[model samples]
Target: MPKLKVIAFDGTEFDLEAESGSTVMENAIKNAVPGIEAECGGACACATCHVYVDPAWSEKVGQPDVMEEDMLDFAYETKPNSRLSCQIKMSDELDGLIVRVPEQQA
Candidate 1:
């Protein structure tokens, strides 16, 4: 399992354990992390699971695909590091992946 760190809008941090190959949004929902609405599950059809990949981890996380990029337009406070958590798969390389939840979802 990879250890993921999720920072809530209010700056609360959650240290979560996530299975490799699972989506970030999945782990978040499973752990009851707030602000990741994931309204469309992991289908990449909604922007509710919006998060900001910590700058230091942005390159490792990579940029979103066309579909995810389009959907992010609907997210709240989209930033240079904004990403749809459902599109980010967990891996050992992401063991310390850090993301910050937006104050609100789409």
Candidate 2:
């Protein structure tokens, strides 16, 4: 399992164990990490699972696809690192991936 670090809006951090093939949003929901709403369940149709990839892990996480980018427009406070968690799959290389949840969902 890869270790995923999720930082909440209030600065709280959750260290979660995630299965390699699962999406970030799925692990977040499983661990009850607050701030990742995941309203569309990893379908890539909603922006509720919006998060900011930490600068250190940005390149490793890569950019979201066109559909995800289009959905991110509905997220709150979109930034250069903004991404839909559903679009990010966990892998061994992402063992220490870190992401920050937005203050609120769209």
Candidate 3:
């Protein structure tokens, strides 16, 4: 399993375990971590799972797909590093992945 260190703009932090195949949103949701709504349930339709990958960890996470890119427009604070958590797969290389949730969703 990989470890994810998901954070929020308000300083909330979640250090949870995740399988290599699951999405970041899935692990966060399962752990009841605040800030990741995943309202679309891992689908690309909603931007509730919007997150900003820490710049230090950005290159390791890679980029989002077209669908995710489109959905991100609905996010509160879309940035160059913004991504839908549902689109990010957990991996050993992402053992310490840091994601920042925005202040609002919807």
Best by TM-score: 1
Instruction: Tell me the TM-score of model 1.
Output: 0.98
Error of 2 at 72 (Å): 0.5
Identify the candidate with maximal lDDT.
1
Task: For each of the candidates, give the backbone clash count.
Answer: 0, 0, 0
After TM-score superposition, the amount by which residue 34's alpha carbon in candidate 2 deviates from its true location, in angstroms, is: 1.0
- How well does candidate 3 score on lDDT at residue 36? 82
Give a tens-digit lDDT track for model 2, residues 1-106: 9999999999999999999999999999998889888888889988999999999999999988899999998998999999999899999999999999999998
Q: How far is candidate 1 from the true structure (C-alpha RMSD, Å)?
A: 0.6
The candidate, 1 or 2, that scores higher on TM-score is: 1
- The order of the candidates by lDDT, greatest first, is 1, 2, 3
Task: Judging by lDDT, tell me the better candidate of 1 and 3.
Answer: 1
Candidate 2 vs candidate 3, TM-score winner:
2
Q: lDDT of each prediction vs. the true structure?
A: 0.95, 0.93, 0.87
TM-score of each: 0.98, 0.97, 0.94
lDDT of 2 at 95: 97
Error of 3 at 29 (Å): 0.5
- What TM-score would you give candidate 3 relative to the actual structure? 0.94
What stretches of model 2 exceed 4 Å from their correct place?
none
The digit string of per-residue lDDT tens for model 1 on 14-102 reads 99999999999999999899998898988999999999999999999999999999999999899999999999999999999999999
| Model 1 pairs whose backbones collide | none
